[model samples]
Target: MTKKIVVLGVSGSGKSLIGKNIAEKLGYRFFDGDDFHSTANVEKMSQGIPLTDDDRKDWLAALNKLLIDNPTAVIACSGLKPEYRAMLRQGLDDVAMVYLKGSIDTIWERHQKRDDHYFKGRGMLESQFATLIEPTEEEAFVIDIAQDADAVLNQALSLLSES
Candidate 1:
């Protein structure tokens, strides 16, 4: 069966990059969840304001639609909170979540180097870390982001194989 994968993490955890690579390897379609966000959501995030659950309702619904539309696909999204992850999983039978786990410092360092992005600097990173509810082993195929991209991808692929 074709796998439906969600590459999930905080900003700067390399979800977009990693998800695209995984999709390419697996011959599945790839989507960046940021592209699904409404302009208002982007504006709020661009101003370094953290999104409330209400703000994410439409966005999450849109992502859910994407998941439904493409059964064999890899999507990059910040499924930070448990509720968020649960929402994503709703109505899906064979979805595999790849949580890109990373420390605040590591994420912040990467965020600083990013020249073009909606999510801003340290404050936004801190908010994301605070909001995140780390997924358990049963909930996701967790991969540490301290490793290089290729290593992370290999580990994720290995875990997905077992799952």
Candidate 2:
């Protein structure tokens, strides 16, 4: 069985909501990658500063450790760059990546509706899209996010069940 599932997407793509639902369905622990960020990283994002690879090094390492420690977990993370994704899967074979895909315009509208999050604004979304390398079909279970949330969750569960 796939023990580690990482939900990958930019902000406003519903990684957290989808990941949490998936975890609940599978009886696995759920983790929001944003919560593991250092105080400095959160501060930078709150100030509208995009995190560089250097800024993410430690954060990614910590997430990788979380995967290593947990036998069954669903983590919502912005696995944007290829290297970042590769690092996330290092030494792990029973891992599954679910990439929630949507257009910038589609996600931008969602981003606008959110108010309780620190990672807000169109600029931040643009920065994430710019950095995103988009995992290939071979690399992840890709799910379209343009549909309703229930449909998206069902599709994810179906795909994961097959794996």
Best by lDDT: 2
Q: After superposition, how far is residue 99 of candidate 1 from its true place, in Å?
A: 0.5
Which of the numbered candidates is closest to the native, going by highest TM-score? 2
Q: lDDT per residue, candidate 2, 38-84, as tens digits?
A: 99999999999999999999988889888999989999999999899
Across 1-163, the per-residue lDDT of candidate 1 in tens digits comes to: 3379999999999999999999998899998999999999999999999999999988888887788888588989999988998888789888899999999999888888889898986898899888899999888988999999999999988888787
**Which portions of model 1 show Cα errors greater than 4 Å?**
none
Against the true structure, candidate 1 reaches a TM-score of: 0.97
Q: Write down the lDDT of every candidate, Cα atoms only.
A: 0.90, 0.93
Q: Residue 81: error of model 2 in Å?
A: 0.8
> 15 in model 2: Cα distance from truth in Å?
0.3
Indicate the residue-level lDDT of 159 in model 1.
Answer: 83
TM-score of each: 0.97, 0.98
